[model samples]
Target: MLRRSAVILVATLAAVAGAVSPASAGGPRHVRGTETIPVYDYGTAIRETVWVESPLDSDGDGARDRIAADIVRPREARTRVPVVMEASPYYACCGRGNESELKEYAADGTVSLMPLYYDNYFVPRGYAFVGVDLSGTARSTGCEDVGGPAEVASAKAVIDWLNGRGTAFDASGARVTASWTTGKVGMIGKSWDGSVANGVAATGVRGLETIVPIGAISSWYDYQRYNGILRTREYVRYLHSYVNGRPAEACADELAAMRAASGETTGDFTAHWAERDYRTAARNVRASVFIAHGVNDKNVSTGQFGLWWDALAKHGVERKLWLFQAGHEDPFDVRRAEWVRTLHRWFDHELHGLRNGIDREPRATLETAPGVWTDERDWPARGVRDRSLPLGDGTLGAGAKGRGVTKTFTDESLREDALVANPTAVVPGRVAFLSAPLTAPLRISGEPSVTLRIQVDKPTAALSARLVDYGTGTRVDHFRSEGVVNLATESCWGAATATDDACYLDTTEVTATADHAVLTRGWADAAHYRSLRFTTPLEPGRWYDVTVPLNTYDVTVPAGHVLGLVIGQSDPQFTVTNDQNATVTLDAGRSTLTLPATGAAVTAPTTPQSITTTTLPGAAERRATDNTPVVPLR
Candidate 1:
């Protein structure tokens, strides 16, 4: 496993070291106004397949891997077109886009059908679309390691080949140069495809002009774990096995190696996780990044986007963000027309070197309501300030209430809705705190955190915290994985052919009118409260501090709504709990909950959870912790 990880790291370093500046071939071109227009025929677009050599031999077959690139370009484009690329493991397996489009080959061995709308819409707009199969998936070679180094290098190799830094061979075993392209590239996709774009751009690879990562993961560890809490076991093996369509016997060792190295049980921040985390590589990003994510996405949490966004900002990278209310979805489905036009202008400005003013626009777009969007200067609402309200017996306020009160609960797994129902009641496994109704609308713009001084009768427990909004309103039904339901009708964006089309089934938002909604929540292991990278055993009855971070979000609670916080044990929906059966006690006087808000103050009464009628069900909650400054948990 160590040798395999080393191979990946070494291959990545070599690929980046050999990179050079992008160049143009200088051929016929056409344009209208400030943007490139659809001046070429889509049906007559050139389709071909090429295999670019990879640097990693992940299969240990004594040969380096080969990556398959499927291209669709306008026949009219001799050399003037830039490229839009998508590297993925799903082309042959899970498929791509909302309709699950797959590739079909012609008798001449060229691609007769290219999957997504990129080939249809952008090829006619003077942009070539290159869909590269991830190594070990589809027609590509080597073992697929999920978001590991081999997969990353394979995608970057495509960018290198486009810029004349690497070599490729066409269908006839003939060497082919990318003289047909200007070497300006923009990578875009959703889910794992988007994650590949992120990894490639993080390499500081030359010729990668920009990237659009929608509903993508920034860290593989965060994908399966939350702060030290493992959400699922053996996902490394499951995902790699799922994506690799090759015979199982071929990559068995590769899969086993990944599972062993992933720290699937301990849930610690091990070397395997550090290697897949992109935040540490944010400084290497040279391309402009336009990121899109759903605040409610469960497949890939918002923390992946939030932490990555923060790291990029600190490095002074050119970036923009779009946060929606849907779960694990694409913004195109939410606002199709605006998204297409906005994406078109973004590519034009970044890849074509046009002055489209996209970079000068506001840096953030957030969906404040079910269908309403707002442009903001930055995320977490620009002027967000950290406001800490001390936890009381039943109230949260500046004035201390519950000075000597101690609250106890047994560490047991329970559904969040059941624990939060009628928040004022004395639930067996959870505690609740609520603030008074707000006088003005409050917009929570950044990550919310909680601190608790707790004592457990056992060595460890799973600590969960939730932030909720208490009021009736129309909200995105995040529990529904499909943010939008597809309809029978279709809408076209570009020209179509017999095998492929530029149109897709129309979709509408799926929403629910509810009295409350869980905005964000987080979970952590009590033993790992001190360090997400390491664990410290408790003395059983001694007090220890723990900090749990809720996923990042941007939402406005109306003036009439009340803010509530619920502290509980294991949340069955998202976590695999220790089931320690330990009795946990929280010191109310020393605990604090900090939030970022635009307008409005927070106040609450004492003893809401201890009393039934006084508490509000489906209440707001953040997190809890002890006295020590827990480093790197968030």
Candidate 2:
């Protein structure tokens, strides 16, 4: 860790020193060390206090209640400075706290706007920072609905208030003069605060410039409920932390609400919990955004990045995505310099009208492995050729042209299926596929979908599929959604169940549950399997496959990479009904996994003709090569 830290520090310093242009240095002085700058020294700074009533009458009680904030203005202020608005529930109990804990603003001649929960971090940066306590949290009035619309409205109201105050800083020695209203504000925060940034962006409020939403949830339903499987472990742990760390009554109420909502868990994207989901809100954000997520983030899945990227792309809004190699609770300073540099360039270009060339940088910048950063033109870059391999006898091979090979399993040898549910225990009669070694650097940039054809003697059964990367010895367990289908039930398309024998069923739409219902009485529980397919982009490499316990299936790979397909019957992690006497078959050629393809070059297009290219935060010096995964463009 020490060696790694040193390398990161060195790389950051080199990047900053090399990236900043001589022309972009005039806006604000970059602080390299701590100095007693008057704008940030609370002792010397002029301080003014004020309160605003909640614009939202929460209880429908027409009367508004008060929210608090502390405004600091530098004694000598000139122009309308850029505003930094911080939204958080974490507040200082008393004024006398650690200097680091305070929201420090620009101490060296920048406007410092400090909101209530904001510490002194805003002041030292010369930014007119406003720290707001959304709705009812902290010293503010109204109930804290967390990231609900009401809280979002409250944030907007605060922005509006700041706008009305103009460039003038309060009595405190901070910059609050009307000369600082650039109307372009940047919102920054993490976790719940990050969610607030997302919510405010969704409101489509004007003058809201750029946003940096880090470690935030994009979909509440998919993340919190575990596809409606009632993730008791995660829920319990979270509630415990909330209850212990937060005020007792508030935590208790939240816990109670979660408990009551347990049975309502359904992984369906359209469910009630998804209403407040950030993915839904990301659709409306018009501002330039920089989204960062920890690859190993457990509380919130890395899948959120993909979801948001897709949404933003669909809306034709460009964004920058960075996936760090950190965990949920890790400190932001791990990548602090890069983050600050990125923000500086971004805000300078947008807020200060500086041509910092941030726009010329790749649309997607990812820290693929530990310390290496790679640039790509777009997310899931095209030209990621697809290659499919076949699954058979624990090995992966190129599938016969237009034909699928098959294997069979009987009752006595169904141990392979059981192993997936219990990794320690291997079940017999399980089929596995191992791919060939990768010949080149390849990334399965998108989700893989599968289709299967089989016959089960039993009237009902369930199927599950997963994609694994054997090279890194790490399972790409991340998925947008994992689905299971019940064979006993009639096929349904757009809400219609097919009761006929000849049915072309697409299992993607079918949602399953633990509850059982009788489908048919059977002498032999038999349902013919037509085909099995799993679709995903594969780079140039070989992969491995494992079967979900208890179900019978097949594996087929596309053209560029090797594929491993595992067929099984039951997955303990998922609820599956295992009945007696199941027979499965793979229809040759007819079964296929269709992977989405983008045929264009994977690299970014040549710098746009009209846009002049400028150097970025680290363009000059060539850094040492390290073993880091190439960052993909998004």
Candidate 3:
């Protein structure tokens, strides 16, 4: 087994060498000039030659793209070494001069395989690390369709090369060898590389071990479109940033073809996208996996995590999820340490027959706010109890205190609580709900659901609910979900002359025509206030029933933490245009909000079990530890 000191040495070396250059009195040396930016010089190290180019013509194409990677022996000269392979479009040597910056800022500096350094971390750790620039990208020759068949085949071919080299097996190719016995290869990458990891895992190639795919989407369609809504901004920007200005016009052409085939300047989730969706691909993955996502990531909705989680759970695939507070950038140190430990533990047990205590970690490690991490036995912890409070008049409270009370008013009374315009006022015209002082701290670790029974005179209506946290007069908006229901669907009739209901309603559904749609609701936080919001069109003589589910959350309220729920017609942050002139009524008896609960004390729910080697079927060893850190191999 590899020693802990060795592992820490490798990590520290990689961090220091890759993270920054030795600071000299003269400041730092400047390197390459790209985009008018000066790149800095980082220290470098020499790595032993693991493999030489040994070519093969497997397809009889007479091409030398199929070269077996020379297997590098582990630092400790172990018999079997775990492997991690990464294939990318980024030229391996492109960032050779900025190894320090690449290591420090790019994907949390763990991806220290850039050609410039020549000291790939995986090779030194006794793990065979393979880097191939997929055919047609960089030095490789062939059409680069991204995740198309060529990419998948190339991945399989790499596996074939590994197997053929006799590195993963004996000379006879019949059994494991002392040089490389475990015969497991994991995939690690981000963006294009991350997407290919999933694609390759879906190929069902043998010896393929675990996968860590960060910030990559499986299907191009689901990411660009949701339901029927068209997401034009983010997708277009991504294509422009990565695909444009490249010397390889073929890559750009492929992207153009996809856009042309979709036939919309702004792409919507067409039938084609749904067919190649990642959620569907997730169903075919057999290897254990971990996914990391950023909650405030505007590029991709955090809901994508839920989609993958739900699919894997349904398929009974062993998987884990980690949510971060950072953006699309690599996670912080605490997170990076956890990731390194996880990868080491997983690969150690599977590839080296080490009994490191990895399998004992929780299935999910969620980031509650910035620095807080919580462990759950499974996704969506079981038996989430729901509690509902009422909204009435200007006050928010429990039970009948605010119920059955209608403060009837003339135009003057309505003016006090309402803002008038062709559409409703976009900001500051909403009411907030506050919960009574808490006896102890309460935490919510799942999604929130809300049901509102309302009365309005208009034929069509839209309502939004927002959850907020109040501290020192600063109201921080947390989670939000909206429901837009046509008045006709609720059996209420609008004026016949009222601008053709067909234009506002489609197939009996109310849809948001603007960017601030109800579908765009969800956020991740360490804690939340016991708060609720109610906003809708006000009309004379009609009542409506509505329900909206706020985005999922993992909240921990400290003891004596005051809970406040605010109900408002509109939030300034989300400006809704074209508000219909109407009056709104709230019925307390028929309205309720549900909060998550576990039948037991809120503080003490069932603890989750960690993944361990013992739980695995054919394990050669085992270790027990009380601490959650990965057990060092020695």
- Clash count per candidate: 22, 108, 34
How well does candidate 1 match the true structure in TM-score terms? 0.91
TM-score, candidate number 3: 0.55
Candidates arranged by lDDT, highest first? 1, 2, 3
Q: What is the C-alpha RMSD of each candidate to the true structure, in Å?
A: 9.4, 18.1, 19.8
Write one digit per residue (lDDT tens) for candidate 3, span 1-634.
1112333443445453244333234321211111000121121211221221223322224553332232333333323445677666554323211111121112422223333212233344445555555544444444444455555565656665455543332223243333443457777665556667777777666777777766565665544542222343334334433422234553555556555645243233444354445677666777777776554333444455566667777887777677654433333222544565565556555554455555666777766654567787776665556755555443343532555754321111111112221111222433334444345656665556556665655533334455442221211111211111123321111111111110111111111111111112421110011111112223456555556555445455544333433333322222221223334566655666566644222211122212111112111211121111210000
lDDT against the true structure, per candidate, is 0.79, 0.42, 0.42
Mind giving the per-residue lDDT tens digits that candidate 1 earns over 422-509?
7766678888778877779888887888888899988788899988887778887766544677878756655556666656777877
Candidate 1 Cα RMSD (Å): 9.4
lDDT of 3 at 109: 20
lDDT of 2 by residue, 1-634 (tens): 0112333433433443343222223334422222111133222334444455556654344556345454443333444555666666553322111111323235442224232222233343344555666665555555455345556776776666666632222334354333445666778776556667777877667778778777665555444433323323334334233313235464456446544543333222332354457667666787777777655443454555567667777887657766654434212333444555566566556666666577887876655543456778866654644443333334433433334455555443232223222211234534434345434444545434445444444443334344432221211111111111223322110100011011112222112221111110001111212211112221222221212211111111223333334444433332222333444444423333333333321121122211111212111211211111111100
TM-score of every prediction relative to native: 0.91, 0.59, 0.55
| Full ranking by TM-score | 1, 2, 3
